[model samples]
Structures are given as C-alpha cells and as structure tokens.
Target: MEENIYNNTYSLLKLIREKKPLVHHITNYVTINDCANIVLAIGASPIMADAVEEVEEIVSLASALVINMGTLSKEHVEAMLVAGKKANELGIPVILDPVGVGATAFRKKGAEKIIKEVKLAVIRGNMSEIKSISGISVKSKGIDASERDIIQNDNLEYGKDISEELALKLNCVIAITGVVDIISGEGKTVFIDKGHKMLSTVTGTGCMCTSLIGAYCAVSRSYFEAAIAGILTMDLAGEKAYKNLKTIDEGSGSFKMKLMDSIFNFNHLLKNIILR
Candidate 1:
C-alpha cells in the first residue's frame, strides 16, 4: 500500500510535468500568489482569473478548477459559481477549499451554496471547516482550525467518521488537513503523519495544499489518490523544509522560503532516491 502511494504520486508528478495542465483558480487575494507558485512548483500551470466577465472562459481552458473561500466576498463567490458550473459542464475536475467556512455565517452559506450547486471532485479543508460543513458542531479560530477540532491519536476514528461521512454526503473526496491529515473517500481513508507544526505558522499552506490537489487532479483518474498526493506533497515538503533548517534564528519566514524550495526541488529529490 505504501509503495503504491509513492509510485502513484511519482506517476502523477511526471504526468503533470509532461502535460503542464493549466489549473484555473478563483481564489482569495491573501494567498493567491502562493497558491499560483505552488502549482508551478509542482509542475502545473495556474491562472488566477476571478472576474465574472472571463471566469468561465478561463475555466474552459483549464484542466482543473480550484474554488477557494479565503478572502470571501459576495462578488468573488459569484465568479466561483460561474467557473465551477462551467467546469462541471465540461467534465473537468473541480476542487474546493472551503477556507474558514466554519468562521462565519456568510462563509458557511457561500460554501454550502457552492457544494449544493457544483459537483466537486474533492473538498479540501482543515478539521474545523470540514466538520462545520458536514453539519457537525465545531469550534473555529478565525481562519484556522480550532485546537479542539484537530484530529489526534485518540480521535482518529472520530476524524475518519466525519471525513467519510462528508465525502459520502457530497459524493466527493474529503481531505481534512492538520497535524494528522485524514483523507477519506467512499471506501478508503488515508492518514498522513508527515507534516511539521511550523506548517501551520505559514499563512497559505492550506491554500497551497488545495492547489496541489488541483494540479494532481488535472492528470489523474482517481480523485482520492489525487487528494492523498496533494496532501502528501505539502506535508512531506513541510517536514523536509523543517529538517533542512540550518540557522538558529531562522523563523517562519525562512521556513516558508525553504518550504517552497523543497516543493520546487521535490522532482529532483525523486531522481536521486529510490522509492523502494
């Protein structure tokens, strides 16, 4: 099983590079640049076009569509719907990042509307946001996951239950990312314990994860595997970035740079290391 994951990820990364699939993003301004950069780092193309006038046109040219609710606004929400409907009509895979859906009624309402309308291939979010959207009562800390909602060893089954329930309900893959990333589909659940706490300190890691998922989904047949690959790429790179930390004074700023570097260099890393 572990080997299958590594091989599948390698194949997806190689396919992404070969195809250079364009990923259309109707995302927030807070992490728009980082979201674009990470998609490029992972060997895919990104276009950030949220204006309603051209959103559907851009999404038509894209291999995958990403809908993010980071900087939630009524106008952007409309654009997201337009793009998502177009993608669905064309059979293009769509990934949703329900950023802070648990934080406010507006965010929650917008997210629910998207799910109710768009046929998402995958729904990626933190524990709190996923729980809240699943109709499970949860506590949220602004845009972050509440400490109480995070998945841990003691609550692993509980986390899986929520993830699977949401995935089954939405008929899409559900990925809850945090200290213990849980990705659940119709019949399978994957847990990734490969991230660093420093990952949370960064501003756009969650958005970046969604971008990665979009990239993989563009070239992969399995949305579930694509979600796992997306989350694994970020988690492994984050863990590697922290491992490569050198100076004592290096903070989250430096760590962010290294994190991007690790992602950009992961293709090269695979060249030298044997998967077996």
Candidate 2:
C-alpha cells in the first residue's frame, strides 16, 4: 500500500509537470501571490481571478478551481459561487480553503454558503476552521488557530473521528491541518505527520496547500488521493525548507523561498518520510 502511494504520488508529480494544468483561484488577497507561486512551483499554471464577471469564463477554461475565504468580501464570495458552479458544470475539480471560518461570522457564513451551493472536491483548513464548519466547538484567534485548539498526541483519535464525521456529512474530503494533518473522505482517513514546526512561521502556507491540492486534483480523478498528494507535498517541502534555513531569524523569510524551491525540485526521495 505504501509503495503504491509512493508510485501514485510520483506519477501525479510527473503528470502535473507534463500537463501543466491551469488552476483558477478565487482566493484571498493576503496570500494571493504565494498561492500563485506555489501553483507554479508545483508545475501548474495559476489564474487568480475573482471578478464576478469573468470568473465563470475563467473557471470554464481552468482544469481546477480553488476557493479560499481568508479575506472574505461580498464581491469575492459571489465570484467564488460563480466559478465553483461553472467548474462543477464542466466537471472540473474544486478545492476550498475555509481560512479562519471561526474567526468571524462573516467568514463562517460565507464558507457555509459556498459549501451549500458548490460541490467541493476537497475542503482544507486548520483545526479551528474545520471544527467551526463541522459545528464542533472551537475557539480561533483572528486568522491563526488558538493554541488550545491545536491537535496533539492525546487527541489524535478524537481528531480523526471528528474529521471523518465531517467528511461523511459534507460528502467531500476534509483535511484538518495542524501538528498532525488529518484527511478523511470516502469512509477512510489518513494522517500526515512529516511537516516541520517552522511551517507555521510562514504566511499563506495553508493557502498554498489548497492551491497545491487544486493542481493535484486537476490531473487525478480521486479527490482523496489528490488531497493526500497535496498535503504530503507541502509537508515534505516544509521539512526541507526548515533544514535549508541558515539563521534563526531567517526561518520565515528563507523558509518561504526554500519551500517553493523544494516543491520545484520535488522527487521520489522526499516521499519516504511522509507518514501515512
């Protein structure tokens, strides 16, 4: 099974590089550039278009669509609906990143609306955000997840149960990312425990993960496998980025650049450390 996963991951990586799938993103402005760069680093082209007028047309041409609610706005929400529906109609995969869903009622409502109206292939978020959408009580601090909400060794089983429940309810893959990332869908679950702590220091890492998922889903038919490949790619690149950092202060700055470089140079060797 592990070898099959490795082979699948390698094949997906090669397919993305060869196909260069176009990913359409209706994402937050805060991490827009990082999202685009990450998509390119993963061997996919990115188009960040949230204009309601052009979103439907853009998504029609894209191989996949990613919707993020980090910086929510009325106009952007409408754009997401437009693009997501068009993607669904065209049979293109869609990935959603409900960033900071528990931080504000506006974000929560917007995310809910998107989920209700669109058929998402995957939903990716931090523990707090996932819990919020899942109706599991959780507290969030602005955009960052509360320390108390962090998934730890003791609550691994609890986390898995909640994630699986949410996945079954939503009828889509749910990825709750933290110290140990949990991905649940199709009545099965996966835990990825290979990322470095320095990953939290960089802004837009989560958004980049969503974009990477979009890239993977564009070429792969299975949302579960696409999500696993995406999270593993981010985690493995994060580990390499932290290792390449020279100074302590350079953690965020250097790590950001190295993360992209690592993704660009990703190979089968990096897949060995990814825990299932």
Candidate 3:
C-alpha cells in the first residue's frame, strides 16, 4: 500500500507537469504573489481574478479554483461565491483555505458561507482554523494558529478523530497542517510528517499548499490522494530547502527561494530519496 501510494503520488506530479493545469485563485492579496509563484513552481499556471464581472468566466477556463479567506472583503467574498458556484457547475475541483477563521467573526462568517455554498474538494487550514470551522471551541490569534491548540504527539488519536469527523461532515478531504499534517477523507486518514519548522516562520506557506493542492486536484481524480500529494510536495520541499539553507548558512529569505527551486527541480528520483 505504501509503495502504491508513492507511485500514485509520483504519477500525479508527472501529470501536473505535463498538463500544466490552469488554477484560478481568488486568494488573499497578501499571499497572492507567493501563491502564483508556488503554483508555477509546481508546474501549473495560476490566474488571480477576483473581479465579480470576470470570475465566472475565468473559473470556467480553469481546471481548479482556490478560495482563500486570508484577507477578506465584501467584494472578495462575492467573487468567491460566484467563482465557487461556477466551478461546481463546471465539475471542476474547488479547494478552500479558510485562513484566519476563529480570529474574527467576519472571517468565521465568510469561511462558513463559502463552505455552505461550494462543494469543496479539499479544505486546508491549521489546527485552530480547522477546529473553528468544525465547530470546536478553539481560538486563533489573528492569522496565526494558537500554539496551545496545535496537535501534539499525545493527541494524535484525537486529531485523527476530529479530522475524520470533519471530512465525513464536509464530504470532502480535510487537511490540518502544522508540525504534522493530518489529511482525512472518505473515512481514511494519513499523516505527513516531512516538513521543516522553518515553514512556520514563512508567511503564506499554508496558502501555497492550497494552491499546490489545486494543481494536483486539477489532474487527479481522487481528491484524497491529490491532497496528500500536495501536502507531501510542500513538506518535502520545505525539508530539502531547509537542508540547503543549513549547508549555505542562509536565513528564511533564502530558504523561501530554495523552497521554490526545490519544487521546480523535484522529480521521481528525489521523491524516492526524500519521501520515505
């Protein structure tokens, strides 16, 4: 099963590179550039269009839509609804990153509204954000996840339980990313533990993961497997980039560039060496 999963993930990576799927993003302005670059790094094209006038048309041309509520406005919310509905109608995948839910009522409302309206293929967030969206009593500090609410070794079982429950409830894959990532869907769960702590120091890494998931889902049929592939790609790249930084004696800024470089140069040969 492990080998099969590895092969499937490798195939998805190849497909994304070959297909170069168009990923439409109505994402936060803060991370919009990073999201676009990350999409390109993973061998997908990204189009950021939140205009209500052209969002539907843009979504129609794309293979996947990513709705990120990191920096929300009324106009962005409307665009998300329009694009999400259009993506649903076109049978394209939609990935939602409820970026700062539980931090503010406005963010919580916007996240809930999107989830209620769109048939999401995958929902990605940190622990507090996921718990808040799942209706659990958790608090978030601005866009950052609460450290206390983070899943620890002792709470692995509980984390799996909540992740599976949320996946069942939403009828989609739910990925809670942090020190460890828990991806659950269709009553099955997987834990990806191949990331670097430097990822937390970087902004928009979660949003980048969402865009990467959009790329994978664009070509893959299984949302669950696609999501796992996306998370693994980001985490593995982070691991490699951090090692590169250590070798060169650089900081987070250099690590960010190396991360993208790692993604762009990533291949099955490196996958076998890094993914185990």
Rank by TM-score, highest first: 1, 3, 2
Best by lDDT: 1
Which candidate leads in TM-score? Answer: 1
Q: What is the lDDT of candidate 1?
A: 0.91
The lDDT for every candidate, in the order shown, is 0.91, 0.88, 0.89
Model 1 TM-score? Answer: 0.97
Which model is ahead, 2 or 3, in terms of lDDT?
3
Query: Taking the tens digit of each residue's C-alpha lDDT, what string does model 2 give over 28-73?
Result: 8889999999999889999999999999999988999999998889
Candidate 3, residues 1-276: lDDT per residue as tens digits? 556666777889899989999999999989999999999988999999999999999999999999999889999999999999999999999999998889889988998899999999999998888899989988678888887877667677888888999999989999988787899997799987778998988889999999999999999999999999898889888998888876555888999998999888777545766467
Candidate 1: pairs in clash: none
Candidate 3 shows a clash count of 0
**Superposed model 2: Cα runs more than 4 Å off:** 247-249, 268-276
lDDT of 1 by residue, 70-134 (tens): 99899998998999999999999999999999899999999989999999999999889988898
Residue 140 in candidate 3, Cα distance off native in Å: 1.3
- Residue 91, model 2: Cα distance from true site in angstroms: 0.9
True-structure Cα RMSD, model 3 = 1.6
